[model samples]
Target: MITGVYSMTLCDIGNTSFHFLENEHQFKVSVEDTIEHLNLKEPIYYISVNKDGEKKLLRKFPNAINIEDKIVLKSNYATTLGVDRALGCYGYSDAIIVDFGSAITVDIIAHNNHLGGFILPGVEKLKEIYPNISQKLTFDYIEKINLHTIPTTTNEAISYAINAMIVEPIKINYQRYNLPLIITGEHGKKFLNYFNNVFYEPNLIFKNMKLLLEMEK
Candidate 1:
């Protein structure tokens, strides 16, 4: 109900899936993985993500303050502060952040940036439409295969389509920006082989919240 957060729900919406982390004194998710798992009921801090697999999450949370779309941030850089801090930690700024999530988001961070990133359906999004429209295509996890360009088989086609769409746009944008480029989220590491001078961070949004909270007072 209020604008401020006692706990931060940092959600990174991608083309494929949503990855979120809750951080204040600690970090946890509805589903446990890593970090210090905390008790859910008395959670002072909260984080929720609504990505590819589940769309219901976006509707489910009682306090669904749109981390990006629902709220207009003062600066674009603040939009990506979570992982930006990691980049800053490595002495880099003014780069492009292309997160390959449920939706492929191409964002331009102008040295000291602002929010309002371009949101596009991820590589798999096209394939997800296959059964209804194409009737000839299929889907598969892009990481397991070794190929470039679009693959020939249905499975391989999914792989190549997602990878090429995901990678090429990044290369073009990074070159145009001529600054450091960062690839993060679920699909980021899968295609790390094709790109260079890029950084891969798994928990950027969560880490960003931790860093921002530390700076307060």
Candidate 2:
């Protein structure tokens, strides 16, 4: 639509880090590098950022798009909309999405591709509560979420709490809805032990982002 070739620079900044993808190229930069680059732009630009990093990145890129402060207008209905669209395109319906990143989000997509249910708090969130609870306890949790009845120490107790807080609710919802579960995040492996019908797709978010970006233009 332009006179010259214009590449899209999409920076998906999460609670943990920034994922910089430039058009079709894989321009991966760390959090520090990204911050420095943002500051270099004279006129600055609108940058999509997380609620946590909004203030910081904005201070750097004064004119950057603060999507964190403003809600994005979406073709799909909800935050889970991107995943729903992609999964539907791939002919995947009746599935549960367990995204375990900063937040463990358990979202259920109905057979008709509508969002049917939801839950939260994956492994990381549980581990956050551990160190404060006891000396031996640290931010350690399984990469998976499953059944472990015998949680001996405070660390184990936190895991158990996370399981009960996150996984068990999903279990209940899955039981209620009767859809298969699909997990994606830093801690997908831990889920392998507990669930039989679980598929781990690490780039669910990336794929969704790509889809949403496409729809934007």
Residue 101 of model 2 has an lDDT of 65
Query: What residue runs in model 1 are displaced by over 4 Å at the alpha carbon?
Result: 1-38, 41-43, 46-92, 139-158
* Highest lDDT against the true fold, candidate: 2
Q: Which stretches of model 2 miss by more than 4 angstroms?
A: 1-9, 22-34, 38-93, 111-113, 116-119, 131-149, 152-155, 212-217
* Candidate 1 lDDT score at position 48: 33
Model 1 Cα shift for residue 65 (angstroms): 11
TM-score of each predicted structure versus truth: 0.59, 0.60
